[model samples]
Target: MDCKVKLWEVYGDRRCLNTFIDHSKAVRDIYVNTAGTRFLSAAYDRCLKLWDTETEQGKPGFTNRKAPYCVGFNPGEDKQNLFVAGTSGRKIVQ
Candidate 1:
């Protein structure tokens, strides 16, 4: 069965600005880019979704080979991004 996690943007005093639905078996990890332009989520669905934070919508991103336990973006690179996901084994999707 697929489950979803709600994403929320917190603002000072306001608490939340936006909320989104994550359609995955289990949302295990999330990574926001340094520019805050995008959000990457890894889940048991064995997929990673890149989302546009500005629009609060999903963007085309990478996919994993198995259920990802973690997701992160590598630093020190411009124009290029690195996504590391911990699945049944280590998988790197760039």
Candidate 2:
């Protein structure tokens, strides 16, 4: 998949919640916030995207480094300002 994040409502009938196509390459990893209100995605396209879970909408949130292999929200103290990402360059960005 070159660029797609398919949010599915696995509860009940199991269907799509939303479809986000912001990356130009395969999305490598996804992470959710502790409160469940938001989430983030890192992709091979060297981009990170943040989503408002309740509204099913998103925006490009982070970028500037190499393509990432993983991304996650940081919880507990200072959580709102902290996010983590792992890149193929063998470095972690926070």
Candidate 3:
């Protein structure tokens, strides 16, 4: 329920592929990149994580004092360092 990410593939039938549990609080949002190889997840733990779709593992990405609500990766190829995350504190962290 909390601090978990479920991977599902809906090709012909519904099936859960895997689940990732690393955060200490509920995961708020998940954002897949354009490549579809990796994704970003925001959690109530006030942290952002980067997860590999293949490995099904998450690595600590970013963090702040306020709880993170949403996250998005930079679509531009050369702008990977410029990601954005919205927090409950009424501000967007870059």
- Per-candidate total of colliding backbone pairs: 0, 0, 0
Q: After superposition, how far is residue 86 of candidate 1 from its true place, in Å?
A: 2.1
Question: Per-residue lDDT tens digits of candidate 1, residues 1-94?
Answer: 2355455545657455665566547677788888877878777777888787788888664666767777777776574366666776665445
Candidate 3 accuracy as TM-score: 0.88
Residue range 1-94, candidate 3, lDDT tens digits: 5889888888967898888788889899998887777888898888899998978777766889999888998889777556788889989988
Better of 1 and 2 by TM-score: 2
- Predicted candidate 2 versus true structure: per-residue lDDT over 68-93, tens digit per residue: 88887776746655788888899998
- After best superposition, candidate 3 residue 75: deviation in angstroms? 1.6
Error of 3 at 61 (Å): 4.0
Candidate order by lDDT, decreasing, is: 3, 2, 1
Which stretch of 10 consecutive residues in model 1 shows the poorest summed lDDT? Answer: 1-10
Off by over 4 Å in 2: none
Best TM-score among the predictions, by candidate number: 3
For model 1 the local lDDT of residue 10 reads 55
lDDT accuracy of residue 39 in candidate 3: 84
